[model samples]
Target: MSTQSERIKERRKELGLTQQQVADPVGVSRVSITQWENDPSVRISGANLARLAKVLKVSTNYILNGGPSRMEEPSGQYHLENNLAAAPAMHGQVPVISWVQAGAFTEVCHVELDPEDTIWLPRPPGASEDCFALRVVGDSMVPRYNPGTLIFVDPEVQPENGDDVVARLTDSSIEEATFKRLILEPGAPKTLMAINPNWPHRFIEINGNCEIIGTVIADMNLRRR
Candidate 1:
């Protein structure tokens, strides 16, 4: 019997759908779809698995234990083999907010958004329902992260050593949030390090006045997308 990952890949190809197409409606990144199709150790949650079955136009049972596609047909559907139209994409969207708005992120992660004020993008897998996105605006993180890169932020994840984070200095007058790699050293204060060595403020110590809004879960260069 074919494994679930193989079955997912097989059905995806049989339908001639790109991973991104499948990912969008499934509320995950294209990278996540790739991982699901290739990584045997990666387990698909029940909700996602059901969504995958719908997106792939197959039954969950077929994905779990392949034999024949027993997927339920749409009402008033034709019975022509391999002639089904693509299923409509269905996925949750994450709101993209401004840097200034990100600074206002409280412990509850409450964001008051007007539908017109924010752009919505697909929510990547593992991100909280309240996850948000920001566009990179400076050269501080340059070498690896360029301007115009879109980053997904999840407030639920704890910031750890070397994690990229969005933070605001509560004591400063600046209202915009900042993004940097967090650094933690034994017997030393936590610090945020800018990836670009040439940047003027390359390293800033995380003092009591500093508030980390959220850790960056994923980032993509919009120019390349």
Candidate 2:
């Protein structure tokens, strides 16, 4: 049986791509590529798998199973890993938390308190359980997320430094969450970021330490006009 590394190397050679060329495109080291091609013990992440899929011009499932799954991207929209129509947490179930700004702030807004304070939606089949959601308010995350927009987050997943994420900072007033991409800064970790280049992504790094809410999962957005 061919190992994942061998398969990766074989595929790369078949495409006439040098290790350096591939590394430059993916922002990883050529040695890392070498290791990936040779090490059978290396387990990759979904994001890395996505990058490989694009580089190989194949589907993610193809890399995993040597073939593609029935899942297909919708005609007009991006296919989220999970569906948003699943039943949300009910009474005594997961409680829905309040909204918090990913950018720096003094106090967390506390209003419209509800019984379901920690309720989160269910994960789709074959999806991870770290998923959660937060409602959007300001235009800081506009274009990608609108006011009142419910954003799904998955903490089990780690986004690249610049990837979008939902950060949960201490509100003191209430436990709240905010979503944004990263500025790709060094050291201090921040969450709030922008998904669209048109929208400026701003993130607030903790002076000491705070919780990273979660990585964005699926989203239920209103149809654009």
Candidate 3:
């Protein structure tokens, strides 16, 4: 079994990329890449690890644990056999922002929020480049998403019926975005539902006033631990 540093160096060499080439995309100095490849004790941040995996054209799991390598076609499509050990597909980091920021989230607007103070988490599997994270704020999504849970939202993905989503009511006084499960019925109006049965206001009719900002792809409740 090869060490993590060995795997990184081996893969980079196979791809004919210099340390600086990998460093440029991962947003690090060439010295950092050299340390990552040469020093086993040097730990890489989750964000950098994910970015390195992408720059190397491999999965994070493959870097952490030796596995069947991923192949990228000339067309840039990534494929691995289904029977192989399942690995979490990650591209980069997603910044954790407030519900208010999430409501106003966009490729353009978020850039102004400044990247330095942002708390970035590892991007979830199958998430798009536009993915962002929001902390669960209320009890409306309880039993599944408790307050303070981190929910990754992806605007690029279309919300299907019964998908958990973050939405904003443009016509209403509600300013911050709300997290709810989207319900679409045939011929009837759509609804945003709360999972908690005891909650008094359990559903809100979409009625065209609600604009779904994004679908919840994954969530993490640190309190559960």
Candidate 2 per-residue C-alpha lDDT over 1-225 given as tens digits, one digit per residue, 9 for 90 to 100:
666777778767866778865564343567878888888787654334544555555565555566433234335422223332323212101123455433222232222222112333444333343233566767777787778777665556766666667665554444555566755567655445555456553445555355665666566755651
128-212 per-residue lDDT for model 3 (tens digits): 7667888887798889878898889988899999999999888877567889999998997899999998888898987878888
Candidate 1 vs candidate 3, TM-score winner: 3
**Model 3 lDDT-worst window of ten:** 107-116
Q: In candidate 2, how many Å is residue 29 off?
A: 43
Clashing residue pairs for model 3: none
Alpha carbon lDDT of each predicted model: 0.77, 0.53, 0.75
After TM-score superposition, the amount by which residue 3's alpha carbon in candidate 3 deviates from its true location, in angstroms, is 42
What TM-score does each of the candidates earn? 0.59, 0.39, 0.60
The parts of candidate 1 lying over 4 Å away from their true place are 1-91, 107-109
Q: Over 4 Å off in model 3, which ranges?
A: 1-90, 106-111, 223-225
- Please list the residue runs of candidate 2 whose C-alpha ends up more than 4 Å from where it truly belongs after superposition: 1-96, 100-122, 170-175, 185-203, 222-225
Which numbered prediction scores highest in lDDT against the true structure?
1
Better of 2 and 3 by TM-score: 3
